[model samples]
Every structure is written in C-alpha cells, then in structure tokens.
Target: MTTKVLVAYGTTNGSTARIAETVAEVLDKEGLTAEALPARTVTSVWSYDAVVVGGALYTGRWHRDARRFVRRHREDLAARPVWLFSSGPLDPSASERDIPPVPGVVRAMARLDAQGHITFGGCLQEGARGRVARMILRSGKGGDFRDFARIEDWARTIAADLTADVRAGWL
Candidate 1:
C-alpha cells in the first residue's frame, strides 16, 4: 500500500490553508498519497501512515484548532511519523532564518515526538478577520509573506524522509 499522509492545518484568513495545500501537492508529486484538511474537520488520524500538522501563529501562540487537534489525537499521532509547521510571521524573517516554534508547538513536538518542525512566512491580505488583523492591514503591515518555493522545499524534505523510512523498512 502507498503511504498516506494527512496535511492538517489551522488557518486564519485562509493563508495557512493554502500552505497546507502546497505541502500536499508537493508530496503527491513525490509519489506519496497526501491530503490537506482542516484540523477541526479531521476526526481521526489513524487512517494515515503519516501526518503533517500546521497552524497559523497569532501573537506567538499556535492556532487553537491545531493545538486541540494534537491534544485530541495525541495517542495516534505519537504512533505515526508526524511533522509540524507554523506560519505566522508577517515579515520575511521566516524565509530568511530559522524561526523556532512557539512554546505551545515546542511542547506538542515533545509530546508527539514529531519527526521535525518548520516555521513558514505568513500572509494577511485584505478581509482578514479580527480587529487586530484589520488594524494591521490598515497600518500597511499586512501582506502575503508566505514563500511558496520555501514551502515546497520543506515538503520535498518530508517526502525524502518518508521515502527513506520506507526503503529502510522503518515506516
């Protein structure tokens, strides 16, 4: 059977969802079966061989749905090869450097024993929710900062890691 991967994400303003989709697309191109779904909609992770959980960062905290998803499916996630990602920096810092996970994500990584984690640049365009988001947009701080090339590169790394595991009889 092909290795199936679930790319679950918690996004605000729909930007992180696009990032999740990109990841799934890259994995699919790399000969893996992958699907991108909203974290709140995924009732179970047991059907997949691996998972990639992503969340939007807001004020240094991960999206609530992503945190809840990890908490709700902790046991199943622990048994699988899991990776995590956060996308929330409005600047180019994420693409320019290694932005570490927020405290909550760090804890989740430890609990799930996730294979790896990455932080991607975030996007905040027009019509974003929340008063703060609106303010940021009005102040001209909101823009699409997500780097698709970087996102794809990360997904390729994941595919390589999974492929390696399969060849070594580890997955």
Candidate 2:
C-alpha cells in the first residue's frame, strides 16, 4: 500500500506555502504519496497516514488557524506520525543567532510527539507591513533566507522514517 502524507500549511505572503509544496515534492520523489493543502481547508486528519504541518510566524506567533488545527486534532495526530515546521527568522546577517521558538505551538506539538520541527528564514515584502510591523521586520535585517536544499533533505528524512516504520509494521 502506498503511504499517504498531508503537507498542510498556512501562509501570509506565500513563502510558507511554497515551502510546503517543496516538502511534498521531496516526499513524492521518494515514492510517497503526499498532498500539500492549506490548514484551513483540511477538515480532518483521519485520511492521512502521516502529517506534516507548517506555517509562517507573525508577531512571534504561528498562524492562528494552524495552531487551532493542531489543538483540535491533537489526539488523532498523536496516534500517527506527525511533523511540524515554521517559516520565519529572516535575519541572514546574523546566521549564528538562534530564533526564538513559539512556546504555545511548541507545547501543542509536544503533545503529539512531533517527529521534528524546524524554523526557516522567510521573506518580507516591501509594503506588506504597517509602520510597527515594518520596523520589526527592519530590525531583523530582512531577506529571503529559505534554503531549499535543507528543506528537501528534511523531507527525505521524514519519508525515510515513514518508510522504515512501514517496513517494520509500525505504521
């Protein structure tokens, strides 16, 4: 039987959606069947054998819908394999600095025993923010810092884990 994976994400300016698509592509290349969908559109988690939820961060928080999805489906998610990814931290100039993690989301993810979680740098459009948001973006030294190679590698690892679990009759 083919493994079914859902790559659900929430995006503001579309960077996180692209990242989710790329993750699905990587899983597809590894012979796993995956679908990339928006978090709001997914009504349930029962259909997928594994799930990967991702979203962009705004004001140091994840998209509300994404957080709600995890909270609502926590039990179902805990019963299966799940992974989480966050897209933010666009400070390429300070490569050594660590991006602060969102505590609420992190706590929710922990309940599901999430396979992994990652924070990727994101882009900020010139006029996409108000005065205060723009100042925050500027303070972060903005740039598109998404690393496709790293994203693909991470997806491959997820695929490998699922594959191994299936082979061992664990899934």
Candidate 3:
C-alpha cells in the first residue's frame, strides 16, 4: 500500500509555501503519495497516513492558520505520524536558539505527539517589513538562508521511516 502524506503550510510572503512544495516533491520522489497545500485551505487529513505542518514565524509565533488547523484536527493528527517545522530566522548559521517558534507549535506538538520538529532559516523580503525594521534587517546582510539540501534530506528520511514502519507492521 502506498503511504499518503500531506505537507500543509502557512506563510506571510509565500516562502514557507514554497518550502512545503519542495518537501512534497521530495516525498513524492521517494515513492510516497504527497501533496502540498495551504493549511487554511485543507479541510481534512483523514485520507493521509502522515502529515507535515509548517509555518513562517512572526514575533515568535507561527501563522494563525497552521495553529488552527492543528487544533481543529488534533484527533486526526494524533492518530497519524506528524512532523512540525518552523520557517524563519534571517541568519544563515542560526540554529534552534533562533527558532523559538511560539507556544502554539508547542501546544500542537503535545496534541499530536509529533515525530519531529525542525527550525529552518528563512528569507526576508524587504517589502514585507516596515521601513525601520527593513533598515535594521538589511544592515545585517540578507540573503536566502533556506537550505534545500537539508530539507530534501529530511524528507527522504521521513519516507524511509514510513517504509520501515510499514514493513514492521507498525503502520
């Protein structure tokens, strides 16, 4: 049987959406049925075997849509394999310290018992911020910090885990 996966995301400027798309592509390449969709638009995850939820960070919080999706579908998510990710932090070398992706993510994770959590660097668009905020961010040097290689590697790992679980009759 084919494993079905959903990569649902919420974003302010579309970067996180693109990331979710790439993750879905990677999972598809691994032979899993995967689709990337906006969290706000997803009505049900009942048909999927696994889910990946991600969102852009703003003032230490993930977008509201993602939070609500997790809340509304908590039971469904808890019964399946779930992974969580937060996209943000302008510094390329930034790690977990920079993520701190709001209390919402934490609550969602508790509700779902997510298998993993990742905090990835994100790009900052000058137009997305106020003038003063843009000036401060621009001062530190800016560029795309999203690591596609890392994202792909992680997706592949998830696919392997799903396959393994099925083989072991754990799925």
Candidate maximizing lDDT? 1
| Candidate 1: C-alpha lDDT | 0.95
1-171: candidate 1 lDDT, tens digit per residue:
588999999987899999999999999999999999999999999899999999999999999999999999999999999999999999999999999999999999999999999999999998899999999999999988899999999999999999999999888
Scored by lDDT, model 2 comes in at: 0.84
Q: How close is candidate 1 to the true structure, as a TM-score?
A: 0.98
Q: How many clashes does the backbone of model 1 have?
A: 0
lDDT of 2 by residue, 65-100 (tens): 689788878889999999988887776522344454
Candidate 3 clashes between residue pairs 3 or more apart in a chain or in different chains: none
How do all models score by TM-score?
Answer: 0.98, 0.88, 0.88
Please provide, for model 3 over 118-152, each residue's C-alpha lDDT reduced to its tens digit, 9 standing for 90 to 100.
Answer: 88888776666556448756686555789888888
Number of the candidate with higher lDDT, 1 or 2: 1
Which 10 consecutive positions of candidate 1 have the poorest summed lDDT?
A: 162-171
- Candidate 2 lDDT at 157 equals 98
Model 3: what TM-score? 0.88
